[model samples]
Target chain A: DQQVKQNSPSLSVQEGRISILNCDYTNSMFDYFLWYKKYPAEGPTFLISISSIKDKNEDGRFTVFLNKSAKHLSLHIVPSQPGDSAVYFCAASRYNAGNNRKLIWGLGTSLAVNP
Target chain B: GAGVSQSPSNKVTEKGKDVELRCDPISGHTALYWYRQSLGQGLEFLIYFQGNSAPDKSGLPSDRFSAERTGGSVSTLTIQRTQQEDSAVYLCASRPPGGGTDEQFFGPGTRLTVL
Candidate 1:
């Protein structure tokens, strides 16, 4: 079963526009969420993250908003640049009984920021 | 100063052969994880390790797959008697001490092709 889902397989947006990517989770026990961006043939890089306790977290041009009740979260990149074109993955993790964190990943969304 | 590193960026082998993938996590990071990505399976968790504790092998697909971490730093994943279906990109990631809050740094991944 896929606990985390990124329904959109691909997204296209013009440069300097707003790009929003969405993700949903089925496990309420997941208390932390993160976003990663990946380029072709490269590993994913950490982007932004948010805790379930907070509704939103922002860093520079990127922002993550979480809605606990809806079991959904989204990453917003404002004034998107062509450099932002990459596959985006939304991940969720929970501290297991042993105190180690285990991550559950989504299928990933490929975002294309056109210049 | 370095992020997670993985070796053998690409590997091609015949079916029935064995393959070993290696990962070197960042210095001072205590957590490590392995994931597999394939066209048919998307992305799935394989295993995880934290310091000197026992690894979480619940995500391993079968007995043929196994992993080991030495000195709580480097890790290696071994796949025995590989089949055509064993082809995929193996990704390694690492996190710091704080569970559920730290971001995971990922390696470029090793793409394995079993012919």
Candidate 2:
């Protein structure tokens, strides 16, 4: 079962514009969500994250908003730059005991920033 | 290196053969995880290790797959009797000692081709 889903396979945005990516999940067990950016031939790099307790979290140009009731979350990048073009993956995981947190990843959305 | 690293960036093997992939997590990171990403698919959790003990091996697709960590550090994922369907990029991630709330650092990954 695909607990986390990113419906958009690809997205395009021009430089110096706002770029948004959305993710949805069915499992209410998910309480922590993270966004990762990946480039070809490389592993994913952590971008931003949010806890179910908080509605929003921001780091520099990136921000993540979570809606527990709606089972949705979004990653926003303001003034998107060419360097931001990459595949973005949304992952969700819940805390249990013994430090067991296995992240469930989305199919990933390819973002292209036009110059 | 300062970041997580995987060996033999690419591997190709014939069917019915066994292959082993390695992962070296970031120094002082106590949590390790293994994930798989097939072509056009999202990342799939395979297993997780906290220190030298793996509390969750539930994600392993089949009995043919297994993983182990040694000395509270490096990990290895072994797949027995490889099949064509097993071709995918195997990624490893590491989290600090705290918990799932921490963002994970991922390695470049090993692309395994089963022919």
In terms of DockQ, which candidate is strongest? 2
Candidate 1: clashing pairs of residues:
none
Model 2 lDDT tens row, A1-115: 7899999999999999999999999999988999999998899999999999999999999999999999999999998999999999999988667657778889999999999
Q: In model 2, which runs have C-alpha deviations exceeding 4 angstroms?
A: none
Per-residue CA lDDT of candidate 1, range B1-115, in tens?
8889998999999999999999999998899999999963446899999888889999999999999999999999999999998899999999888644758889999999999
User: Which residue window of length 10 is worst by lDDT in model 1 chain A?
Assistant: A94-103
For all the predictions, what are the DockQ values?
0.74, 0.80
lDDT scores for all predictions?
Answer: 0.92, 0.92
Per-residue alpha-carbon lDDT of model 2 for B1-115, expressed as tens digits?
Answer: 6999998799999999999999999999988989999998888888888875645888899999998888888899999999999999999999998654669899999999999
Local accuracy of candidate 1 as per-residue lDDT tens digits, A1-114: 889999999999999999999999999999999999988888889999999889999999999999999999999999899999999999998867988678789999999999
Best by TM-score: 1
True contacts kept of 1: 0.71
After TM-score superposition, what is the CA distance of residue B26 in candidate 2 from its true location, in Å?
Answer: 1.2
**What TM-score against the true fold does each predicted structure earn?**
0.97, 0.94
Candidate 1 has a DockQ of 0.74
Residue A99, candidate 1: C-alpha displacement in angstroms:
0.8
